[model samples]
Target: MSRLYGDPIEVWTREGEPIQFVWRDRLYAVRRIIDHWVVAREWWKVDDDDPGERRFWRVEASPGQRLGTYELRFDTTGAGWLLVRAWEC
Candidate 1:
């Protein structure tokens, strides 16, 4: 398999939502949704009483209008997003 770019996204229950988006400096008509995933996690120990809060959903995000399929992350944390997984079909 070939290597990809960008970061990991925090998926949720939103349809056709933008995990990442872009508008090229050139032409248009290059929109595509090729990313998908389900994320169910809780921020307990890190958030306090507001802990045990579980989240779930499916997301198909991407990066830029040119390199469309390039994945990226909107990581809630400040360390920046890391590519955890992806789909190629």
Candidate 2:
């Protein structure tokens, strides 16, 4: 089962890919990127000059123990990084 958690987190990226992140004062290293996609809801309503896309990355990560799946988002409208969902693996 997956759980939702729209919490803001600090993410470190390398070459446009997340390599590590800090959430709840715990550091989790991204072992692999399970999947990635971009969402632009109501694209027809968005202004041409506005950045409305939200990039999502589903990663397999761990903090030195059991690995877990985490979904992170980077909103182009300046909403920043958000830890969207999680699943224990």
Candidate 3:
């Protein structure tokens, strides 16, 4: 596993797969999706009005220079996207 951080970001998707994202003023293109899953809501931790299910993806990406693996997520209840974690190998 990689070191985790809660970094909110803007993402662009194609046919339900994330294709790119903007982080720290730079844009990175997702080269491939390694894995993906849906996280059910934690009802005990959040109110009913809070975001529902969350969809997560682990992907290999590049910012035009260096390659890295990143974990990104989308909230189904309309809270938008987030870059949850990242690492280079």
Candidate 4:
């Protein structure tokens, strides 16, 4: 099972990809990026003042011996990084 967080976080990236992130005061190093995708506003809602496109990265990360699967989001309209979801390993 996974948990939804939606908490703002600080992320460090390499070549535009997340390599490390800090969440809840602990730092996690991304071991691998499992998936990556982008979501855009619907064509019909283009003028609805949406937050623009959102990019998501599902990654395998670890802080010490505790490894977890995390979903991170980047809002193109400048909402910044968010730790959206997580699954414990």
Candidate 5:
């Protein structure tokens, strides 16, 4: 199928499980849909007594609002989207 994209956003499964929504399309099968996602958590960091911080994720299949992934994060260099973080399962 062709690729799809959207603002990497958060979603919840019908069972209330948290899943990331990274894409949107008119495709549907059984378990999985036509959306990309990221199963992410908190990543804290510190250096030279510069305090500490964590990074959030908005992972996707493409980079922008197209057919791909987009990971918007926050950390030392701020946050933005990426072309692809890892391959979708």
Candidate 6:
């Protein structure tokens, strides 16, 4: 897996499920969502109580000709969307 820290992206969702995303100047259509979960705020690591949760989605996608699995995250604290990791399948 390759890590991408804070890589900005645009996602298209249908009924709260991510259908596709644009990242690194390419469009990737999600074929399947492998997992979905929420990361709760780490209260002990922060000074304040406003550490918002993060949503994560692991998906299998096709970017043009190649297929890959990627981990996407959304920060509720205004950090925006991020492409966390990706690997060829």
Which pairs, if any, clash in model 3?
none
Clashing pairs in 5: 60-69, 60-70, 61-68, 61-69, 62-68, 62-69
lDDT score of residue 2 within candidate 3: 83
lDDT for model 6: 0.86
**Model 5 poorest 10 in a row by lDDT:** 23-32
lDDT to native, each model: 0.37, 0.93, 0.89, 0.93, 0.34, 0.86
lDDT of 1 by residue, 1-89 (tens): 33444443333323534443332332212244454454433544455433332222223433423342334444433433444334433
* C-alpha lDDT (0 to 100) for residue 19 of candidate 3: 97
After superposition, the stretches of candidate 1 with alpha carbons farther than 4 Å from their true spots are: 4-16, 19-30, 41-46, 49-68, 79-89
Models 1 onward score TM values of: 0.31, 0.91, 0.84, 0.88, 0.24, 0.82
Deviating ranges (above 4 Å) for candidate 4: 44-51
Best by TM-score: 2
Q: In candidate 2, what are the lDDT values of residues 1-89, reduced to their tens digit?
A: 99999999999999989999998999999999999999995856687788488899999999889899999999888869999999977
Q: Write the per-residue lDDT of candidate 6 for residues 1-89, one digit (tens) a residue.
A: 56566688999889977899999889999999999999977877554646787899999999877889899898878757888888876
Total clashes, candidate 6?
0
Worst 10 residues of 2 by lDDT: 42-51
The TM-score ranking, best first, is 2, 4, 3, 6, 1, 5
For model 4, residues 1-89, the per-residue Cα lDDT tens digits are 99999999999999989999999999999999999999996686565666488899999999989889999999877869999999988
Report the candidate with higher TM-score, 3 versus 5. 3
Candidate achieving higher TM-score, 5 or 6: 6
